[model samples]
Target: MAPTGIVLLDTYLPTSDEIAAILPELIGDMFEPPDGIAHLEQLRLTAMGRYFRMFGDWNPNPVSAPKLFVRPGDPLREHHREVAWRAGWPLPHHSADVGGNHFTMMSEGAATTAEAISRWIDALRH
Candidate 1:
């Protein structure tokens, strides 16, 4: 994105490897069509192809304004957090281990996600 404003990333993974890495977990965790694997294959292909086409390079770019990176609260899943930071994406000035996985953070953990984001923004305003 054209860096210009405040940002809140909920497990903002930007690479195919990141997507692929979590595929195993996602296979059974999501509500998909009977052809779940097929659907995921399409998603996987997009991560590998369409993502780069739309986003330019994998290189990290500078981001201005306040930033926050919130992730699933699962302690065992901490490695994703580590991987995220190492991707050269603009580092979040603030970080948190919130609730739910990458996708659940939007649905099952939507409330938690909202609260976390709200707190982040409130802190930024102060």
Candidate 2:
């Protein structure tokens, strides 16, 4: 989705450990190598024990602006989009299909996905 105001552009969320690891490749536009390193450092600063504990306590209730743009779109993307559409504002954009791979893209398709995003952003700006 387009950002609501002049300040925020989009939200980048990496939900699982595997996805987080591949995130640098998937969403390279958002950060430089240094930024990725910094994010890793920040993640390390948090205690793993505390992080694991939150899994059981997680709750579904929330009230806030919708976060947009989920990457590495797979079957799960459509599922979540359906849920979000029912709940409130549907997500604005999903990651490119990339030849339907749940795992990392295979060279040509990855480039295709990247190009798609570039075009999408350019279109949004104009």
Candidate 3:
């Protein structure tokens, strides 16, 4: 089923250079997966290799659907909101800034995120 609206929670749509810079770090993060996870390292390496191969030619297709960008107030990745706006993605009446960085936002700021989403959905239904 097609979604009526989308809630983007600190999503990253990286440029080629950004991908190149972060690819190694991403692979590093996948290392040392918990014990008993068979072939995890190989799987991560394979995926990273595939992503690297695709990065140079990557392009973000235009999205027509309404979107709500939930930005974290912490300042590291807040630029993502502007990126979405510049790409012409439609935003809700107000962009929500939950108080945590990208990773922590989901866990620490989950309530705020949920409330913002609920408000946006309620507004749409009205």
Candidate 4:
């Protein structure tokens, strides 16, 4: 699910010139000191051109509730947590701290993660 989100975000990012126009104020540190408004404008145009040509109006996912297979140490997990909190959810049904970086953790802990997800999926199936 999170991977899909990243893909979507990346897809939208290049085309989000309107959104990026405000990014300098929000993330002023992205540029070094003495950076001018032209830099920001350039960034907007670049992102708009990249994104506009990259993604379609819609994605191809079949389900609204996206499914993600991610390790606990993955940075995206934190983003997922933030989104869940912002949505006012009480808690996530399942998450585990599998040690390692993204690829390492996925390789080492795929079975455990799959088992955990299978449990939830099976419950829903019944």
Top model by TM-score, which number? 1
Number of colliding residue pairs in each model: 0, 2, 0, 3
Per-residue CA lDDT of model 3 for 49-126, tens digit only, reads 676576545655656666787776663234544432221123342466777654456776778888888999898789
Q: What is the C-alpha RMSD of each candidate to the true structure, in Å?
A: 5.8, 10.8, 6.7, 11.1
Model 4 ranges with Cα > 4 A deviation = 1-71, 74-99
lDDT of each: 0.56, 0.37, 0.57, 0.38
Off by over 4 Å in 1: 1-5, 11-20, 23-49, 75-92
Tens-place lDDT digits, model 2, residues 1-126: 644322112222224444344444433422333221223234543543354466434433433433323233442234433332211112343333344233233333467556656665665567
Name the candidate, 3 or 4, with the larger lDDT value.
Answer: 3
Q: List the candidates ranked by lDDT, beginning with the highest.
A: 3, 1, 4, 2
Comparing 1 with 3 on lDDT, the higher-scoring candidate is 3
* Candidate 1 clashing pairs, residues 3+ apart or interchain: none
* Cα-based lDDT at residue 73, candidate 1: 61
Which runs of model 2 end up more than 4 angstroms from their true locations?
Answer: 1-95, 106-108
User: Lowest summed lDDT over 10 consecutive residues: which window, candidate 3?
Assistant: 84-93
Clashing pairs in 4: 1-67, 1-68, 14-47
Q: Which candidate achieves the best lDDT against the true structure?
A: 3
